[model samples]
Target: MKKRSIIGLTMGGLMLIAALCTKAVTPTLRLSDTRPKIILGTAIPTKFGDWQEDASQVAAVVNPTTVAELNKIYAETLSRTYVNRQGNRIMLSIAYGTDQRDNLSVHFPEGCYGGQGFAVGQTSQVVLPTVAGGIATSRTVATLNSRVEPITYWVVVGDKAVPNSWEVKKVKLAYALQGMIPDATLMRVSSIGEDIEQGYQLQQSFIDQLLQSMPPDLRGHFSGTSH
Candidate 1:
């Protein structure tokens, strides 16, 4: 009986040591101080290339209810209306979250548009060829009554442009494993026009020109790459 007790005590002590060692080696999934915080307003250029901000038309793109929901999720949101010399207009909306956990992830455009009574159609993932490289993004045409808006957007998870929910989770997990909480930003650009193709072309042009016009360091906030 005494020998059995000694063996049991040795096993218990070994288990306690193993538990303490694991507690030390295992990384806690916590926010790392090394990650940089991105400020949306300052990071994005107001007047870039041929596009200039139209302050008065800001309210025409997004409704109140959607804005209210956005306020809840995003740490900072920027909504701007830009028009070029050719009279083409693009609405730019960027939402950033410091903590991109499952509960605080971005509210993607399809759901937001659906909530606003817009029918989402022609949804597909596209690789946008930028100066940095090919960045993955999603495009969709949303319709409501007489209005048709084509949107081209991407979500940056950590420093990568994630195309869909799966990629978002993958990237987030990658960061979490490194003991860091990742930040995310949803960069969206849309134009109102009946021709979805033309709208997309214009939105792409706007994005390209905007990226080119921005300072080198600031471009990564939109493009999700250092280049």
Candidate 2:
């Protein structure tokens, strides 16, 4: 029999916990503030454990762009990509803020769930404390036995800027969604090959969404590709 693998994701080093035990902090959104806590479109090295640098590095690039463009990219990518170790192969980001509720519900469903468990206590690298004063975050990681693979996630609550280029941004967003798959299911070549295809789709969608959502001033900056 093929080795059954536990899909796992380590989000910046944070762990998933039971929703009931978890606190829901109301996110504060301000239309006026568009500036990012960190410089937009800059490379952010991996701060978490051994898990690959694909997602975090990706976000560091695109989070600063407009939301409209980002969403466009997101929807497109998911259609093209497949969930796997490489990254999320989807393209949907609109549900991010709201999906926190959805994922929490999945994680702590009314009945018994196999991936219900979370990583043992939090690790320092897992948590990315708030910056810019307005941002707050809630994250979780889930493992899928045969269905989806395991993944780590970061649900940021705020009108804060995302880091990285468009490609990286898509990776981060996809990871947030597909991170639930088990690790072992992803090791297979078939799974990984599909993931790469999906990764590009996710990246394209992220780019489209960020471009669509960008404010006039920011959009100009992105078009020029200088800084």
> Number of the top candidate by TM-score?
1
TM-scores of the models, in the given order?
Answer: 0.83, 0.22
Residues 1-227 of candidate 2: C-alpha lDDT, one tens digit per residue: 23322233343224554442233332233211343322232321122121223442333121212356434322111111223254433311222222222222111111112224323222111222211121111222223433332222222222222222232244334433433211000000011122433533343333334434555544333322212
lDDT of 1 by residue, 1-227 (tens): 99999999999999999998655544454342455566777777778888998888898676424556667777888889999999889999888877787787887888889888999986799999877667899999889999999999899877889777788988887777676777788888999999989998899888998888877766776788752
- Supply the TM-score for candidate 2: 0.22
- Runs in model 2 with CA error above 4 Å? 1-141, 160-227
At residue 144, candidate 1 shows an lDDT of 94
Please give the lDDT score at residue 151 for candidate 2.
23
lDDT of each: 0.82, 0.26
